[model samples]
Every structure is written in C-alpha cells, then in structure tokens.
Target: MKNIFSPIEQIDNLDAKVIAGIERLATLFKSSLQDTAKRYKLTPLQAQLLIFIAEHSTKLCSVTMLAKEFSVTKATASDSLKTLVNKSYIEKVYNPDDARAFSFVIVDIAKPMVNELTHFGLLMSSSLSSLNENELIQLCHLNLKMLNIFSQSGLITCRMCYSCQYYQQKNGGFYCHLMKKELPAKALRLDCPEHLKSS
Candidate 1:
C-alpha cells in the first residue's frame, strides 16, 4: 500500500496535524510544570533558573551570565538571585577572577526543595519508562523532527516578553519587545503556541 507521493508531499500531509499536536502538548507541559512549580512556592522563572543552575552544577554562574542566558537585564537577574538568596535558597560568593561579579551556589537549606524538583522530573520521566529501547529511540527521533520543523517555522517566542524581570524595570511595565505593547505583568508569555527560550 505504498503510495507514490514524494517525500516533501508526505511531509506536508503530516506536518499540519503533527505540529499542531506538538504545540498543544507543549501547552499541556507548561501547565503541568506550572502546577509543579507552585507546589514548591516557585515562580515559573525561578523554577526555570533553578533547573538551569542545577544542570550546570560543574560551573559557577554569574548574574551577568544568567542575564545573557535568559535575555534579561543584569539588574533583573541580580534581583531574582537576590530574592533566592534572601529566601536562603542560593548564595553569592565573590569571584577571584572578577571582584565586580559574584558566583552562585545552592544553599544547603534548599537541598530538600531542589531534590523535590529532581524527584518531580524523575516522576514525569518514569511515566514513559514503560517504553522499550526502540520505542524510546523512535520517540526521540520524532521529537527531533518536530522541533526542527518548529524552529524552521520562524515563529518562536521572545524572552523579553516572557521574563518578569524585563517588565518590572520598564516604565510602561511588561514590555514585549516583539510586540511593542504592554503585556500582562504576571503571564510574561507571548500568547503563542510555539516559543523559544534564549537558554
């Protein structure tokens, strides 16, 4: 029952439904992640920052680095880190190479919270643990193709519209660099199905 359609034709036929489903799935993921983050008393950005920091456990991070990574102003990054520090979740250490910059460290008091985040991620991973080797590999490949198409579509979201730090500093508040309009201070999202993270 093999059809004589060209590769691109086959792709075009599958593209619309698959892309729409993937985008919807991403929306679901965001909602679920938001719920999980709330359980830990973390804002979406805070949770994302924590995850990024934990992933780069081998390297010391800086406010400037985070600002660049998240497409936020250095002042915004400093304030977010300050909030975490005040909560005793993270600590700032003086950098030997640069006196003006400080390195980040996870405070011992936050291990439980951090560990819970890990546990939640693992729980989600385990939801797919039933898939055997081939299925998992195939799924990975499918996701890669989906992401490739999504990236090529040129509809990804901008960070300026997504970070809380960006909005607080602007006079109008909640500025969307892409839209040039005032956005909801809390959401900080592009209201799009497909968005990109600078990091």
Candidate 2:
C-alpha cells in the first residue's frame, strides 16, 4: 500500500502531491476533532454522532440509518447513540412515519456545541485564506474528483449530492434524477439516505 502522508517532494507527480496534501489536511482535521472531543469529555465517535444527528433532518436521524451512513454495524451505532443519549446530547423519539421505528433529535444543550463543531474546519481556515475564489472552486473540483476515486476504491463513501447518481444539472439549476424533481442548490444534502453512487 502507498503511504499517503509521504513527503510531497518525494512524489514525482503533481497529482500525487495534491492527494498527499488532502490526506494531510484530513489528518489534521481529525486531530482537531479528537482535541474537541477530549475537551467535551466525549469519545470521537460520540462527537461524530452528535454532529450527524444535528446536521440530518429528523426523518433521516435513526439508529439504523446512521449505521448504514457511517458504514458501521447496527450494534455499534446503538452503542454510540446510547452514549449520546446518556450525556443528554441527543434523544430518541418515535418515528411519525413508522410507529415501530425511532429517530434521534439533538437536545437544546447540544445545539450550540453542534454548531461549534460544524465550524471546526475554521481551525484550518487561515491556511486556505490565501486561495482566491477561482482557486477555491478549482480545489473543490479536485477534491471531488479525489473523493470519487476513493469511493471507487472502497476506501470511503460520501453521500453528498455531487456523488449521487440522482444528481443532475440542467438549465443552470440542479435536479434529482431519481426524485424526478428540480432541487435547489442550497437544498443539496450531505448525508442523503437515497444516495446512489454515480456510475
């Protein structure tokens, strides 16, 4: 296996260097998450669960769904949910659509913390401040391309609109081919359960 964090100079190809940089950035971001989790007296998985529930819509916030989204087993998802519930960070409620099912809701006490965690990327914002708007857009495209490659390799899966086969762009607007409806750019989901990998 290739060492993703090897020194950029040692890499002969520019693309390889860029991939290494992305890996390095991800490492640093995860380190930040670990630090934040430590301060809040929660495990990293617990912190991630809080963020996931906070970001997802109520209908999509169930333990079974989370297990699938996070690629973890049902028992692992239940354990993490249990920890969050015990800490009063989230609560399970009966699913309105299915009486037999339940979903999670972030508690009021956790709202502010969840908001803070959402902006944790700000820790590395300064490093990207030098990039202009066009550069940022280009970087975004490159990152998406790399994400697709990783997904193909079974290294990771992203449920973002751009990664879903349902995603479509038409007449300067976005649409969901699967849903057969026009979708607003702002409404694009980051953790959609309906996501199907683009071919």
Candidate 3:
C-alpha cells in the first residue's frame, strides 16, 4: 500500500510527492479559513461567499454562478446567501439583464469584515513570496496550465484568461484581444469579470 503522506523519502514517485504537497497546502488553507470564519461567527461557506462577493463582479455573484463556483447545490448557495443578507453583509440587487434574477453585493457595513476575511490567503502569499520572480512566474504558468486541464475535463469551472475566447498565444507570450494588452506570465488572472468561454 502506498501513502502519499509518507515521509518524503518514502514517496519516490515525483507526481505523488507533488500531490502530497498540494494536499498539505489544501489543509493549510482549510484551517486558515475555518479559523477566520470562527472568529467572525460565520460558517466557512458564508465567510467564503462574503469574501468572494467582495472580490468578484456583481454579475458573477448570483446563486447559479455561486453554486458552480463553490461546487454546491443551488439551494445550498441560496441559503448561504440568505444568511449573509440576514447578517447585513450583503445585499441583493436586481439584475439588469434579468429582472427575475438578483445578484449579491457586499454592503458598506461589511467592508471592514471583508477586509479581514481576505487575510485568509495572506500566509500562502507570504510563503510564495520567498521564491524568485522567475520561479513565481513559472509557478503561475504551471498552475494555470493545470487549472486549464481540469477545466477542459469539466472537473471544475474556471473563469481564467487561458480558457477565454479573447486569450491569444502570440510570439511565445500571452495577449488578451479583448483588453488589447500583453499579459505577463505573472499577470495571468485566475478570474476575470469579462471572461467568455472559448469555443
């Protein structure tokens, strides 16, 4: 029996080692988010929803999009949104494109809490800061490539530049035709408001 959690020396396969490393990082993120959520008296999902609504555009903050983004059922997402609304952390704005639909927006009163909630990723960012600039760029590229593969397989939905129709690979670099700008490897976005699925 092979265990990826075994000592580094015991895991000879590089791919398994990488998976183990990612598992460890996932553990760290979960713990951090849980701790923050507890401090604010919010469920992990509610805290996550609040933080995501603060960061993303309103159009992407609806129950349907939130369900897809968080891999939760629409009912679960809607319930969480209701909790946030009750807590006065978010408000529903009628969608202009669809009057029957409403999207969420963080309320002014929750700005401070959202600022604190966003700190959940601070430690991970600090850890990555130890790498050289080139290494950071390379790591970003690798992560985007891996995310694209997962998105293509329908394992998860990602609104990333690499999967957007406007994304272009030119002269061994990246360009966004919609933005009409060259994207440095480090500037590749994991989420963009204007992302459109590529055919």
Candidate 4:
C-alpha cells in the first residue's frame, strides 16, 4: 500500500494510482525541459528560469522569489540568474523601493529562444487535446482544486485564480469579481498576472 508503483492489481486505492500517473506526467515535463536545456547549452534550472521570466511579470522574477518557486537555495538561484545575465538572456531592473534588490526581464535577443522554450509543454497539451470539451472541463476543475490545496499549504507558489481575491465559488460554479464574469472551468487560469491574494 505504501508503494504507489506496486502492481496495479495489488493497490486498491485510487489516490496512489493517480499520484503515480501525475508523477509520470511530471517526468515528461522535466525530460522535455532537460532536452531543451541541453540544446541551448544551459542548465535545466537556468532554462526553466529563463522560460519562467519570459512568461511571468518581471516583478515575480527576482532571485528570492525564484529560489522559493523552484525550491532551491538563494545562492543557487542567484548563480543561475547570473549566468542568464552573462548570456544576455535577461536584463535586471532595480527595485524602486530598494536599490540593492532587482528583478529580471527577458532581453529582446532571447525572444526567439524563449518562444521555442515555451513549447516545452506542448507535448502535454497535445496529449490532452484528445479529450472532449466536458472531459477537459472536468479535468481542469479537478486539477485546479488540487493546485489550490497545494498553494494554500505552502507546498508551492502559484498565481492561480483559485487563490486570487477575485475568485468565487457559487452554487457549484466559479466567478471572477475583478473580471465581472462567471468563469467556465476551461477558462480558469493556472497563472494570472492580475492575481491579487485573497485576504
């Protein structure tokens, strides 16, 4: 029972199987990122950090935040970021409140590579493309529920709608107060720049 990888017939609990499947999916994502990193001559974490900077707001790309996000030490995050700066993939912007602190923005020259890097998730996306609309909706809703739980527990950091002040659940449906609209399960965002933590 403790081993999720025990033969499927030996494990009766659905949760273990589900976790095992998710771990496999995570492995695929890591493999794709690793391959991309090798091609770009960058470390896996550095490549991931570059992609993260390209997609997220610069304010969220600081060394401190990046370290927490990736579960790495500040020194490791800072070293990777320094490598990124040396490679000219990103430029630093000083914090207006504290000149000693800074964040990063992807450089123009790295846009093409960043665009390619963003496709690292395409394999996962494509695998799910075969699901019907309702199935996709159900999957999205369940995944969001789990993600929200993980975020709430401080196991991870996320800017998801489920954790945002604007998000609401009413009569078994979701709404976004900031957007002034009901949110269809498929429309829910895994990460939103406009996210404001719920008080």
Candidate 4 residue 161 Cα shift, in angstroms, is: 1.7
Q: What is the TM-score of each candidate against the true structure?
A: 0.57, 0.75, 0.91, 0.93
State the displacement of the C-alpha of residue 116, model 4, in Å, after optimal TM-score superposition. 1.7
Which portions of model 2 show Cα errors greater than 4 Å?
Answer: 1-9, 13-16, 152-155, 163-166, 169-199
Which portions of model 4 miss their true places by more than 4 Å?
8-10
Instruction: State the local distance difference test value for candidate 2.
Output: 0.78
Q: What TM-score does candidate 4 reach? A: 0.93
True-structure Cα RMSD, model 1: 16.1
lDDT of each: 0.61, 0.78, 0.88, 0.88
TM-score of 3: 0.91
Clash pairs, model 4 backbone = none
* Candidate 4: tens digits of C-alpha lDDT, residues 1-199: 5777776633787878788888988898888888878888988899889989988887899999999888899999999999999999998999899999899999999989977776878767888888999999998889988989989999888889989999999769889999899987799998898999998
Better model by TM-score: candidate 2 vs candidate 3: 3
- Give the TM-score comparing model 2 with the true structure, all chains together: 0.75
Off by over 4 Å in 1: 1-13, 58-60, 68-75, 142-199
73, model 4: CA deviation in Å? Answer: 1.9
Q: After superposition, how far is residue 119 of candidate 4 from its true place, in Å?
A: 2.2
State in Å the error of residue 133, model 4. Answer: 1.0
What is the Å distance of residue 87 in model 2 from its true position?
Answer: 1.0
